[model samples]
Target: MHIRRICESEGDAAGTLWDHMCRETGDGRPLTERARRDVSRMLAASAWHRDAFCLVAVHPGGRLAGFVNGRISTGDGLLPGLLGEIEALYVVPGDRGQGAGRALARAATDWLVAQGARTVRYLSCAGAHDDHRFWRSLGFEADMVCLSLYREP
Candidate 1:
């Protein structure tokens, strides 16, 4: 398996994989809405590809097994400098537990470090997810916890 930057030709497969990730942690939202939102975000990233990064893992037979996205930012008012963030990561069920995820993450984080990021951040999806442990295994420690309450009136 090889990990590398995303290419234009893989757009459709990558989009599908991204929508799948959204659905997994999206708390039952409709797929159409998810696709809409993912596409918009992807277009924005594609618009300024120099400032953001996306990586994909390919299986031996040339299928896209998983993908990750990240960006280095010239921080917001509070942070005040360049910061690296692991924006999104997902691996197909068939490819999990075999180090593909780790390799993708390492490539992104290493790139961030090379870009002079002193601080890198990542937020796992919803409650008590198993991937939290996966992030920890990569030497990442939780810096904060966020809680939310959703209601309908």
Candidate 2:
């Protein structure tokens, strides 16, 4: 597999994987229009168009296997520093455990570092089963947890 920077023309593919990953990880709930719009903005804006970076992994036959998107940003006031925030990382089922995720994350991390970020961080669902082992292997640790309380419908 080969990893490459994502271009604006790849929005559909990236957005498709992103929406799927979000739904898969969001307790099976579909995203609202507002959320979809936000994601659309993110997908359309890359390092060339915005302060963000996105990388995609390509399979041998040129299929897109995974993608990682992140942005350079100052941390929340509480954290008190500049850092890169990884917004999404998704690997198609068939590509799991094959290093595509790692390659994409590494590329994103490298891009963030190039943009002057000394640290990179992302949020994950507290109770979700995921390839966090992959993150841990890349030197990421659970520095903190975000809490959310949603209305019961």
Candidate 3:
């Protein structure tokens, strides 16, 4: 497998792969078709795409097996401080346990640090799972638990 940053020219492929990963992980409750289209649009919007860095792990046949997207932003407060956040990380089922996820995460974090970020963060769903250990192995510690109350739209 090969790991590298994704370029603007690869936006369509990246968006399609991201949509597939989201669908698989969300079971039957994945984003709506409109939302998926919106995601693709966002990927092509240039502004948002430029604000974040995307890392893709490719297979020998050139298929993307995993990816991570992150951004570094400063708070809007009076005294703004930089924060690095990983918005998504997904490894296709066939690529799990092959270190693709780790490589993508490492690349994403390193890119964030290069962009002048001081701290990195990612969100994992509630309840324990092997993924928790994966993040821990990457030197991430559980800092706080957040609860979200949502209403059906």
* 1-153 per-residue lDDT for model 3 (tens digits): 998776566667767777777776545346677877776565545334646777888888888787788777884533346778898888888889878889898888888888777778888887646768889999999997899999999
Error of 2 at 40 (Å): 4.0
Q: Report lDDT (CA) for all predictions.
A: 0.78, 0.78, 0.76
For candidate 2, the C-alpha RMSD (Å) to the true structure equals 2.7
Please list all clashing residue pairs in model 1, or write none if there are none. none
How displaced is residue 126 in candidate 1, in Å? 5.5
What's the best-to-worst order under lDDT?
2, 1, 3
Q: All candidates' TM-scores? A: 0.82, 0.82, 0.82
Worst 10 residues of 2 by lDDT: 125-134
- Superposition TM-score, candidate 1 onto the true structure: 0.82
Residue 27 in candidate 2 has what lDDT? 60
lDDT of 1 by residue, 8-127 (tens): 667667777877776776475435966756664673464348768888889878898888888888777367567989988889988998988999999889878887777788987566
